[model samples]
Target: MQLSSLRAIGISKSFGAVAVLDRVDLAVHPGETYALLGPSGCGKSTLLRVMAGFETADEGRVELAGRVVRRPSPERGMVAQAGTLFPWLSLRDNLAFGPRESGRGDTEEIVAGLLEATGLTEFADALPRQLSGGMRQRAAIAQVLANAPPVLLLDEPFGALDAQTRLRMHEWLRSVLAARETTTLLVTHDVDEALLLADRLGLLSARPARLVEEIPVPFGGARGRHTLSDPAFVRMKAQILDRVMVA
Candidate 1:
């Protein structure tokens, strides 16, 4: 059998007396984008952390490419909400950091490619502090992509940006992810964002979250900006909204 890009079987987690996840099973195929959506404090981030190997699950297991994910690895790249980019490092330097640290050859080539891929080539030399939130987030993703991870974990990565910026980031991100063909699992509270970015959307229940539903996005290939305005898209959002509100 072929290994999934990412897989979790009966995964559960807790913090002291509080249980955050309960037997959550999910799988993301290679080069597929899966989005997890739920209400506030629904353990979406916790689940992503588990898969990223940042936090251990109280029960169950997470696997990446047929291997158990026991700790953080470059094979599973994560992009968090904020404070991801190093404030002192320039965009170019930040992208180069991973390859340099991992002793991966062709650091310059990798950094240059990331800069161009993320449309950050013009600001390649700018420090994280000098860039806007969206730009920083893009650089953060670029930094992760530099390592050539097979699976990407995104935890509300654009939640901190303004609405307009977030939308633009969505477009840019979709383009980048498509071009790279990297497997991705995104956690988001926004229904629109989930519908726009994912090939499959999983809705989670409230605290001690479990998969409520695995919804396949109704749209066809390569969604565009206008796709969000389509009736089918709106209907899907409404359908998801109903479940998310009550989940």
Candidate 2:
């Protein structure tokens, strides 16, 4: 079998006495987008953080490309729900920061490409406060991608956007991921978002969260607004919702 881009093996975590995760195992394959779907406060973000090495697992370990992950590194980049772009920096400078600090010679080129890729070319000089929520979120993602991480961890990155804006971002993100082929693990409570974006879905039970199911999203390539209304998509969404309700 092909190796996973990121893997959490028998992972568990707890805060004082309250267990948040319990023996959760998940693998995000190379170049594939995997979503962890669960109810609110279900430890989905905790699992993603553990995989990112920001939080250590109490019972198990996280692996990146088959190697044990010890701490956070540029090899795995995370984008959270709230935009993390520097308030004072222009979008261009924000995307350039990582590469420039890393002493990469092609910082300008990388920044330019990411700006174009994220449709932020026009807003390259705009500060985070000057942009819309969706724009800032895209900039945050672009900043992460500028590091060229093989694995991307998305912690409900679009949760704050309005419905229409979020839908537009879904389409844009689909094209971006298809082009870059970055292995991604997204944690979201939105079933439709998960169904729309992921190649597979990892359904988690309520806290002391555990993986209850690993569902394959049958929709293959570039999904659009029409995907939400498709019969197959509707059926799968209903089925997954039922499972989540009972989980």
Candidate 3:
């Protein structure tokens, strides 16, 4: 068996007397997108946070490429629902910030490539306030990628976008991940989104969440708008919905 790029081994967490996660175990393979799907407030984000080292697990450990994750590292970059770009910085500067801060010499090349990759080259001089929600989100993700993280933690990064824009982003993101082969762990309550993006889906129960089922998505790669209507996709969506309804 190949080693997992990111692994959550028997993770559990609680606040006060309320347990949020209950012995959750997950393994995301190299360059594969794995999503944790569940109802709202079901501890999906908590698990992602623990894996990102933003929050420590009470009972277990998180490992990234065989090293125990001790604290937040640029290697495990996280993009949350809200835009994370600096409000005052242009999109170009935002992408360059990480590399420059880390003292890398190729900031210009990295920034230019990210701008092109995210289709934000035109908006490179624009501030976050000047961009649409979707564009800002794209820039947020681009900023993270500029850091060259092997693992990307997405905490409902598209939850705030409108339906149409979100759909478009789904397609764009699929292509980006395919090209970069970034190992991703996404947390979302949207079943369709999870089904559309992930190589495998892990269903989580309500509070004190547990991994109830793991389903492989057979859609292969490069999903588009048509994917939402595909028979297999519809069936899998329905199946996952049914599981979530009962979870």
TM-score of 2: 0.97
- Native-referenced Cα lDDT, model 3: 0.91
Q: Which segments of model 1 are wrong by more than 4 Å?
A: 1-4
Q: Model 2, stretches more than 4 Å misplaced?
A: 1-4
lDDT string for model 2 (7-47, tens) is 89999999999999999999889999999988889899999
TM-scores for every candidate against the unseen true structure: 0.96, 0.97, 0.97
**TM-score, cand. 3 vs. native:** 0.97
Show pairs that collide, candidate 3: none
lDDT of 1 by residue, 54-145 (tens): 99999999988778888998888899998478878888989998899999789999898889888889998998988889989998998998
Model 1 poorest 10 in a row by lDDT:
1-10
What is the Cα-based lDDT of residue 68 in candidate 1?
A: 88
lDDT winner between 1 and 3, please give it: 3
Relative to the unseen true structure, what is the Cα RMSD of model 3? Answer: 1.9
Query: What's the lDDT for residue 36 in model 3?
Result: 92
